[model samples]
Target: MFLLMSSNSHHWNLMAVASSSASPQEKYDVFLSFRGADTRNTFTSHLYAALCQKKINAFIDDEELKRGEQISPSLLNAIEQSKISLIIFSEGYASSRWCLEELEKILECKNSYGQIVIPVFYGVYPSDVRNQTGTFGKVFDELEKDRQEMLQRWRTALREAANLSGFDSDVIK
Candidate 1:
């Protein structure tokens, strides 16, 4: 990124800020977020494998986290330490409260810490996520029956995340 600075002599000077420069070091280069049951065996596994083959530091949760409970401290720390987050939004993604919680934290890191987030709409559409249409909308309706406040957070997070430019699996081929 280049910045323009105004000088005392009424002339503007250009300053270069390279966005690609590597930082000192981080625990992980990328953190994976997805509905494990949906893509764990197919697209996500392939993605994790490819990232490993290229020697990229990626984090894939080793143990499955159950829903509507205290999240592991380590997972929260992982989100803070990673340089990038890859959120794989599948058909049933919003159904998992745990996934919604993770998405909230990921977006928080994005706003407060500048952690990059890349949303992947796998077997779904970005508009569906942003608008909470289709399965996403259905899930929220269920969540609204009880956890209304938490559900609202999830909806806002999805809307913000889906607003970003990301890859569509259907368009890959």
Candidate 2:
């Protein structure tokens, strides 16, 4: 049975269980976040390969979770335990409310647990993330019109995330 834990406390998931046989050095060093439909086979794949080549353990989602499905407690615990979070901000990322919530949680870890957040501006400008321009701006505008409080929370998260050190896709290649 999948256990759903409160957002206020740490949720544990059986799927995320670490092996007792594995040493501490075998643990993943980074948790990668990206919109799979946007750049899964290209940029994200390459980045993951490179990190693996360098011996950096990285975790990335292979399947998209449906909206309204509970995010597994194991996944949340994995994100919290990772030493670094590499967020690949594609154009459509902010449009998904789920991704936005994941981003918010990552930011929470950043502030409270000192997890490092490294944003990768994939096909979008860093300014766009900072200011919520283009598609991102449109999404936020609509959310603000319909849900003021939620929009405020999202805006605060976006602002904090934008301040993190990042690289554009062009620079990466």
Candidate 3:
């Protein structure tokens, strides 16, 4: 199965469904986690369209629903209900509190419910995501000191998600 992000053409497509089998109890085939400003209009949107064409039910949050400081209960619930999660780790992924929160929940679901996690390293190196180096490392300095515990969780999640086998946009196209 391939999640092809054609760099030259700036189009994305899920080249193949990893597995035809799906759990009957699951509400969705996939859950998308991404930084809105980084990929909402381009990569994520095109990927979602590809999933839809394959008749894969996926959950992608609307911009209006992300107006709060905390992640929504429904968004977390969607992660739990999905059979798989495709985390598009872009250049600005770690900078967004929202994206970090979603990453944490996706990993939690993976550990607790056997939900599959496929990390797509888009434009950023997997090592940067794992070690929080380069651009991924900069966001930690700007966060409030009071958020240390939450920040630790985010870092742990990033490291864990980066370790999983998945796609890297830079090498693919």
Candidate 4:
């Protein structure tokens, strides 16, 4: 049986919930998806540290994927293996193609394996993500027209993730 968190009255019983059908092959409890340039030194770092303090095995690709135009296989595997995916939508998240690829894979896993996906709007509005407005839409404008199909996939993933129940850092702080 694999341990999972179950919510009760906004409280999570981290150790109490178990899933017998959950994959034993899962190496991580959560897969973190974020733009390093935006949150590597600030929010993402502290969030990762806090998860570590709680003994939550979370995956954050800081050094492993420093120089890649495409999302690496190992990073995709990390997303597939995790029970939950936490997407931190910052100012530049939609600017990176690599980040968009990761987001697509996370949503795919959510559909196929029943993986949980949570979006954290960090200094960004959910409407902006869903509608691809502001910086999010500006990045799409800069992309080549030849990659229209891929662009559409990324947009759908962003919209879907933005619609989920999640924390808005702006509201919390």
Candidate 5:
């Protein structure tokens, strides 16, 4: 009877352990969000290479998703688990709806999860990002044509995000 009780207790403990165990997080050191056509082969590539050289685990999307397709759940999980997000605000960045959505996610993560957001103003001004000037303004104008409410949200997000500390590529050049 004592041996049977011990075996039952062991099984119960194993069941408890299995039930309580959580899956491992897909943590990343950095997540890079950029307009691939604008800078992927140049600045984005260089930045990714540099981060890799520094032994940082970085995620950058290299493939094109079909229209209406969602970003991979694994990649989204990685983004959520990343310590830092690097946003490359190039000329055509605001033109891409997918990039805008990714930017929104990064900003949301920063606000809710204490993640660090670093904006790289590549050939764009901080004021532009903050105030939606120039290309940023033009993109917002286009967005406002069909989705005024959503554009407002994006504007607020862009303004708040631009306030975060970052590097200006023009200054580096």
Candidate 6:
């Protein structure tokens, strides 16, 4: 009877784990989000290399993805497969439509998949990202002028992402 109970418990545990796992299975441990123009060569590259050195599977988009009218399918696939998102907020972050789209997708994953999100205020202030002030404010103003329909969505995404617990790059050593 004791042996039978132990075998059943182990089987149940395996079933529970399988049921709770991600549907498509996560491929990368971390997803790096940033303005390539701002940090691709410096902060982002260094961070990616560090993660790699530590044997952490990180997805950092290598090619310039911003030029495309819409974000590539592969990028979206990468985002969906990532377990965590690290958003590196810099001065020009809010200026690009592509970055904004990525932010929206990341937040969506946070809600749907329980994906962890960590924002990094690289050169800009967190308040700026949260409130859309300074550079962020200017960028939004221009975006709103051009694409009025998308303004609220982008703003919400910014506010939502900024509210999460994250690091201020200036404070880091």
The Cα local distance difference test for each model comes to: 0.79, 0.71, 0.82, 0.82, 0.73, 0.80
lDDT of 3 at 39: 92
Task: Flag regions of model 1 displaced more than 4 Å.
Answer: 1-25
- Clashes counted in candidate 6 amount to 0
TM-score (all chains, Cα) for each model: 0.83, 0.77, 0.86, 0.85, 0.79, 0.83
Off by over 4 Å in 3: 1-24, 64-68
lDDT tens digits, residues 1-173, model 3?
Answer: 22333344444545554666656667887899999888999888988888888777888987633545788898888888898899999988887888888998899889987898999998999999999998877764566669899889988999999999988888777
Itemize residue pairs with steric clashes in candidate 6: none
After superposition, candidate 6 runs with Cα above 4 Å error? 1-24, 66-68
For residues 1-173, could you state the per-residue lDDT of candidate 1 as single tens digits?
Answer: 21222233422232424356655645777889998888898878877876776566789987776665676888888887788888999988988887888899999999997888989888888999998898867765676567778878888999999998777766653
Candidate 6, run of 10 with poorest lDDT = 1-10
lDDT of 2 by residue, 1-173 (tens): 11111122322111222234432432457888887778889878977776666566788888788867766776777788776787888887777676777788899888887777888788887777888888767665655367678777887888788788776665544
lDDT of 6 at 28: 83
User: Which stretch of 10 consecutive residues in model 5 shows the poorest summed lDDT?
Assistant: 1-10
Model 5, 1-173: lDDT tens digits are 00000123212111101123222453676788988889999988877776666566788888866657766776677678777788899877776777777888898888887777888888899899898889877866665467877677778878887898887766655
Give the total clashing residue pairs for model 2.
0
- lDDT for model 4 comes to 0.82
- How many backbone clashes are present in model 3? 0
Give me the runs in candidate 5 sitting further than 4 Å from their true place.
1-26, 66-72
In model 4, where do residues sit more than 4 Å from their true spots? 1-21, 64-68
